[model samples]
Target chain A: MSELLSITATGLTKRFGDVTAVNDLSLNIHCGEIYGFLGLNGAGKTTTIRMLLGMIRPNTGSVSLFGIKVQPSQSSIWQRVGYMVETPHAYPDLTVRENLEITRRLRQMSATDAVEKIIGELGLMPYANRRARTLSLGNAQRLGLAKALIHHPDLLLLDEPANALDPAGIVEIRNLLRGLAENSGVTIFISSHILSEVARLATRIGIVHEGRLLKELNANELAEQEEQRLAVDVNDTVAALSALGKAGIAARLDGKNSLIITDKPTMQHPDKVATLLVEAGCPPTRLVVEQRDLESYFLGLVGMKEEKKQ
Target chain B: MIASVKAPDNIISKLVPALWVELKKVQRSKTLWMTALAFSLLIIISGLFMYILKDPEQARRLGILGAKAQIFGGSANWPSFFNLVLLMVSLGGLIIFGFIFVWIFGREFGDKTVYDILSLPTPRVTVVIAKIITAAYWSLALILLVFVLMLGLGAMLQLPEWSAATVWNGLGLLLGTGSLTVLICIPFGLVASFTRGYLPAVGCIFLVIILGQVISQLGNGQYFPWTIPMLYSGAAEALIGKVTAPLGLISYILVGLVGAISLVFTCGWWRYADQT
Candidate 1:
């Protein structure tokens, strides 16, 4: 592994009995890069995260973090890495502060104010004295994040970080993570099933489907991958469809009675379609260029892969 | 020019913080207080029996107590009281101490918090060691508290035979039997770890208790880890007149080996086994 790489997993493969959980998985996450691992629910996201953290050893390959080999015995590497595998859980009987204190001690953080600072940063100050079992799901998730961040780790591996959070809490965590990456240069590997959530913060996104990386794209490249179309609304949808088809621009009516044009030429030139509709005596009521959102693109990729498998 | 060097990390420094974390979990949970309450109740019941045995004439007026007291061969002296306490400790310690061990190890799985500790600056083996140490001391503290309660109850009842030798011997037997019982409870930590829950481990404890009672009745109590403490405490002799000879060193060796193997296996499981 290169010295600049924070995480490197080469040809990693894990199998649970006959089921291959992760197959031929390889990653090279650089220092201070936010790598979003996008997958569906059972798409081997958590399994891959566990393998990265050395919670589960890969059957065929290996992982290294911060130039040190990732193994159960390598305790020093964890000093610079923080992670939350799945739904975060705490000792139900301990207060929020006490739970954080336990994590602080286990992480060997000597600073006295580390617990209080994290509690305040995660907006958990009100529930600091409250027992963990009594906190709401959002607050419990915050406590989990606080534990991971209390040590000021250089690399964070979060699986479904937005799980069990309200919209505002999600935005707050997003901003916090963005600030960490921008200011402190913390390298984060976040895995989530929601592409929209990951797309908003991830600088590099890896789309995984059925335990295989389908595609990897930079944040800017994601826009290029999205399928574009020109949706046209008119008083007579049938007339607009015929006009576009007669003009050799293959178009179909969508569920909402709008003409959907997937041809590149028509997508690039919506004004030409407007002129065609005007000449056809059904002036266009609406003509707008539309691009697929990140979520649909993700589903299309996964669905396309599934179809190929079948 | 001057040279600066960093100190090497030792196991003690690593264990201290993990041990502190484990002890904090033990202190904050209700299992400790509940087990103490259960042990106290057992002690109070032993005292009630001692009171009944002390006053058989007063018990004769009561129906069942009169009949039971007549058939009882043991008197209500300090020696008999100490014997009763030892027998109770040997039998009750298996259930209580076994529970403490399971709770300390298995609660991490039950509460779904095992993953957090698995990857940390502290190694997994260190975490296991800290838990085992906490469980050991916690079991010892509960045994000590019950022993003190028994002493106070004996004083209040004013049983005869107050020799210093008798007190010392009783204390020795209680501590020895309690220690042996705690030793056998170590394997339950392994059971809890591999099974990933408390139900199987708790069931295993009860199975061991039943088998220990039956096996002790069959005169092979010296070989069984669960029955060794009872045999050593002379409970087999006092309760059923079955065990006559004193336990040899082999019995203690067997208990120690069981504990050592269990500790090793627990640590190895945490280190090598896939936690998923």
Candidate 2:
């Protein structure tokens, strides 16, 4: 494993009696890149992260982080890894300054860089003296983010890190995560329901559903999965259907006048369809182009698993 | 020219940071200040009545030591008023400590913060030990602080000289009383780590305390109260020159060993535990 591959695990499996939470999962995350681990509830995202952290052992598999084996006897890799699971609570009783102080002490972060510098970078000075319990969720998250960044660890594992945050808070955290990955060369593996936000921040994305990794694709790959669904407004529905059939293009009528065409939105495909429609009696006009949504893309990827179960 | 330095290892040190973070919860939540205020008031109120208005003059002097001894304990010098107040200090924060401890260890699941804890590089056992250690540290510190406060009160009242044996006995009770908290807490900490809520962990605490109170009552109170504060240590009885271990040393060892071993086993499942 290279330094770029901050964490690597293969054939990982965890069983609870008869139930298998994670099954032979294998993954390698690179340094200075944000990898989004997308999954629904109980989709083994948490289970996999736990194995990576060595909090739980896989029944049959091995894990190494930063080139070091993840065994109970070895924890040097942990010193260089930072993680925030679920909704992190800063010491509610401790003031912001005190919380940071404790985090600094825990991470043993005494060197040229200090807690004061990180504290300032996190913009926590205003509420530095107030108890953590009194801070807003956004502020508490900032404090959590501050704690994660205190030691400047090379690897960060976050699970639904932005859950329950307002839009602004989400954007702030998104910006912060991007900045960390871009400027400091930190490797982050994060999981969240917000796939588009994940797309905005993650360099690469892995979609896991039903304890299995469906696919791992980059932002560009997701964007490249473009499909065209057009709204065709026609006067006579029968005539429109007849014309669309003649063109060998598939389309369904929306209500009575509008027909939706499902096809690739390439210029050539749309142009060919337009030529075929104009040749017919009902010439199509007011065609609208729609991009594939995350939900649609995700459903196209993993929704079939649920359907199979049904 | 500088020497190349090697990075430090040993994950145990990470516990300090994570535990420090856990301890800070008390201060951030206002529960610490709230507990201290409530404890201070309880001391000033009930203690003033118990010590000052209750003919403490007789309790303080060697003149009435015989009568006071009958009432407090058999020839134990009526627990110098300060020590009496200090013993009662534990009672004041018992509820608060129970709540805080449950929150620290179990409430992560209750309030969903366990995810934050397990996701970190810190071990599950370290998290468990840190909460217990934090609670134990605070309990011991507050008890000692109250003892000092009572010492000041004793001076103001001009109480008679307290014996070295009484002081040592008081110290033993003070340490021993809180030590019982460790035995009491670890089992609950295990349950807290194993179970899913603050209520069940808290329910276990009450069960232990209630059982201890009932057992102490059934055993003629004073004789066994000090004896079983964590175990049947003759340390308190030894303070007054009484010899012979109250319970077999092996019994004491067994109680600690069984509790420690059970706690560790519960931690074994933790290797499979997720962020929560």
Candidate 3:
């Protein structure tokens, strides 16, 4: 069962002198899957990524990339891995081509189709000779990603890969990442706070909070949980909401006369609602079911009340 | 989509990429090269002018014997312009080399690009080692270029003073001074790793330079820790023929013990820098 695991981190812990940035975190990422690691600000996502790259020594536990226990001194496993960490900086002086060549030499890659391959694939042929420093932010990010992609690793770990990208750049990155995973079966472990993008790109997701795992689920499951709410428009929303409650259904006021039915409402449940509304001197004018979004499902899990703050 | 990386055989090979990567970044910054070139040219031009003005007869001697001739001032007028050039360049090289080393490491943090550096295929230790060697290579290149340039400058200026002894003294001084700069770099580099900005590293280098001068003033100061690189060999200083026992003792203190210990600490302590 575990043979197919591309990355398996167990009981990983890292600390500064006084603060525990990541504590006893365990994660399993199967092969050929896009796993999103989600968390808010300063939630140890960056620290965990560093450990897997063997950039830091975890105070305890272990991290294995491609099934080999990653060691601080031993760097063999990196050959099969590609990574982009937070706020990545590129060689400002090097033209995009020179940057690619340097990475080529470091990896000891041969002079064969290597240059043409990366250039052709990353669509970087246009900016090949332009000095990296002069490229705009979106261009620089594309170049940074291009540099990372040159090695063609089986596993790609990208931290906020799309953070600095503009909308079009973000779409390009998502498409490219998806293409890589689909064509080459590369397992990607990505961490981001952008839930909508994560939903679109990830096949599986592991949500992290305060240096601990909150949940792990497939995109389908998280989405399924959101399709439960119904939106209703009516007059006398207070009477209507009470009408819904007395009818053994729950509804919340969205505005003066608008209500959202949070619980699933069958045909019989609506009859109970209508009867209660007549007794409370209020009747519904219109009703419609609203498709749920993962955001609300997430808020539900974390117990965030939807107070129409938006 | 990794296709560019070649797995290095061991720690040393891995370190090369890291060093190469950093050097590439340095090269990307035009200001870095501007500073290095300006420093080199300033030393070469100044040393050349002084050699020609001080000893006309020696300057008049156009012999490319590449030797140091004993002249009016023990160190300054040592026959060939090479020795004069070495002394001046060494002053600039010591600070520039150390500053470059510190900036290479310090800038990564100060600029907040350290994560990009360490996240490459190689480990952080390899990255640190790479920065060390990258700075060493540039510094060494600067030293050798000055040595060769001085020899050429002597001919072009048509100086009468020329000898093989001058070459020996110049090479000797460069080596000693270069070694000292390398040693100075280790501590400053350490300070760079911990600090918020590049200023701390630059500050420590200035402090070392100032303190070294004060110690030299206390007594015969042209030896060991004082001159660093060539202090042990006393080549150019030997041409000048002025290395006191205390100076030699300081040289030993710097090259033999202090430098080695600092390297060990940096390796043990800074090998796995958190880099934030």
Q: In lDDT terms, which candidate is top?
A: 1
The native-contact fraction of candidate 2 is 0.22
Per-model TM-score of chain B: 0.93, 0.69, 0.76
* Candidate 1 Cα errors over 4 Å, as ranges: A231-260, A268-289, A304-310, B1-8, B66-73
CA-based DockQ, model 1: 0.49
**Which digits, one per residue and each the tens of the lDDT, describe model 3 over residues A210-235?**
78878898988867765755566677
lDDT of 2 by residue, B140-212 (tens): 7766665566556555554555667766766666666666544445556566767877778778767756865
Cα lDDT for residue A12, candidate 1 = 88
The candidate with the higher TM-score, 2 or 3, is 3
Q: What is the TM-score of chain A in candidate 2?
A: 0.83
Candidate 1 at residue B32, lDDT? Answer: 86
Model 3 per-residue lDDT tens digits across residues B54-150: 5557655844421333341333443535545555655676677777777777776765656554545566666667777777777777777766666
How well does each candidate superpose onto the true structure, as a TM-score? 0.92, 0.75, 0.83
The candidate maximizing TM-score is: 1
Which residue segments of model 2 deviate by more than 4 Å?
A13-24, A40-42, A59-62, A162-176, A182-184, A233-242, A248-287, A304-310, B1-6, B9-104, B107-131, B149-162, B176-181, B213-227, B230-251, B262-275
Clashes of each: 0, 10, 39
> Residue B9: error of model 1 in Å?
2.0
Candidate 3 error regions (>4 Å)? A231-246, A250-260, A266-275, A282-289, A303-310, B1-32, B48-86, B110-113, B117-127, B156-158, B220-250
Which pairs, if any, clash in model 1?
Answer: none
In model 2, how large is the Cα lDDT of residue A53? 77
Q: Chain A in model 3: its TM-score?
A: 0.86
Sort by lDDT, best first: 1, 3, 2
